[model samples]
Target: MTIQWFPGHMTKARRQIEDKLKLIDVVIELLDARIPLSSRNPMVDEILKGKPRLVLLNKNDLADPKATAEWVQYFADQGLPAFPIDAATGTNVKEILPRVKQLWAHKIEAMLRKGINPRAIRALIVGIPNVGKSTLINQLAGKKIAATGDKPGVTKGQQWIKVGTEMDLLDTPGILWPKFEDQMVGMRLAATGAIKEELLHLDEIALFVIKYMVQHYGAGIQERFGVQDLPDDMDNIQEMVKVMEAIGRKRGCIVSGGKVDLDKTSLIIIRDLRAGKMGRISLEKPF
Candidate 1:
């Protein structure tokens, strides 16, 4: 099934960002390390219109280091400096301001040449929902200036937050495009909790997670859930269901008649994946 989510507030946010571009010196694009490409909004490049941008892969703590490293290099190859950071734990966050300054160094130097002291860098930070935009902003500001939540759409409005005297951040609400052109993108977002759970079919997301892990991270899944004899065919729906059921039984997700509660089991699988209980898993890799 195709997944689409475009709230009315997000439309307003897009327009507001355009109106405020005149004041922005640099754009910060935050992406989930596990699904960096998928978490990126397609409209970003067109909207920002070649503005200076620093791509930050947030939530790296829960993502596979190998894949994250590859993604960093991938962005670097494209001339966009990208790095992995854990906004929640403040890992690699200290480098943000330095990098922002580096991106706007030319502008800063121009002011110095005219005998004028440069002002704080005006940065516009944008990202898809639940990609840790709020958490990163709070970390940078060294306080809770932005609302933080695990679910998407926690920050509904744009707010200017001062990051000391070095930078001023414009935090915009996380936005998704009107429609996901690729169905896989929707599944990955839903599986990673970037999309609201209420808008998802949990079973489908659970299966997608299982199939991905089985293909690229079978050992971790087998060790995490103590399930063996994983199906060889990635397209075998029935075999995958058996594996999910086995995981549910192991996790004690049983209901009336001793049948596995698929819904609860799905939630458990997705939760474990997000919480890193299944190890440093990444739903996608740099292609």
Candidate 2:
């Protein structure tokens, strides 16, 4: 499976972000908690070099709490202040400012020493699409300043949003790399809705989700779909097919010919996973 999704607009977005980087004091990088590493745009480090950064593990509400913690610690070890946040619900939104300020303290001190009046910190909000950048920005601004759509590519250009009197934020379009060096990264992004659903093989992604759940979250699936026995091993296609058929039959995703509807069944499973119906799960956790 070769997965690569990079539209031309993302190129334009990256160029704009590079140009806008000099105007900001810090970069607040948002990442889907379920796929912190995979959802990260590879170009961020180069584009945001020398800028103090804050990483928000957005959608922590839907991710395994333990994994989220490990990821936070991992980022902290790398000199970043990373926190778990549910941006859609405004969880931990208030806590962002202090951490970012703390990161920018040295610059603030330098300004004070130079007899320069300190200016409000400006942070560029960035992340992969649908990873909650817009939602987080809206929460920070206390209004819907940035477009918050459930799908990717909602916010297209750059705009500065004032958050209170002391802070300014630049909301940029979420970006992914031109090509994924690892195919599994693309799969993870698709599974977490970071990439547009129409751009990938939803059925393959759904099967990957189902397989992962069966391995790490069987009981949760059993409760959500009322299937007491999901196949324990997904490596066997026949066994996996049986499990999908069972789910389709139970969920009433059947056609007039009395056959299981793969598309509807796939959507049902994927939706349940995204909506937290299958319990908190993390596809890739830091070791």
Best by lDDT: 1
For model 2, residues 84-181, the per-residue Cα lDDT tens digits are 99989998888988888898899889999999999889988887667776678778878766354444966655567777766788755434452356
Identify the runs in model 2 with alpha carbons over 4 angstroms from their true place. Answer: 1-10, 146-159, 171-181
> Number of the top candidate by TM-score?
1
Provide the overall lDDT of each model, using Cα atoms, as 2-decimal numbers.
0.85, 0.80
Q: How do the residues 81-126 of candidate 1 rate in per-residue lDDT, one tens digit apiece?
A: 9999999999999899999999999998999999999999999777
Candidate 1 weakest ten by summed lDDT: 171-180
- TM-score of each candidate? 0.89, 0.88
Per-residue error (Å), model 2, residue 157 = 8.8
How well does candidate 2 match the true structure in TM-score terms?
Answer: 0.88
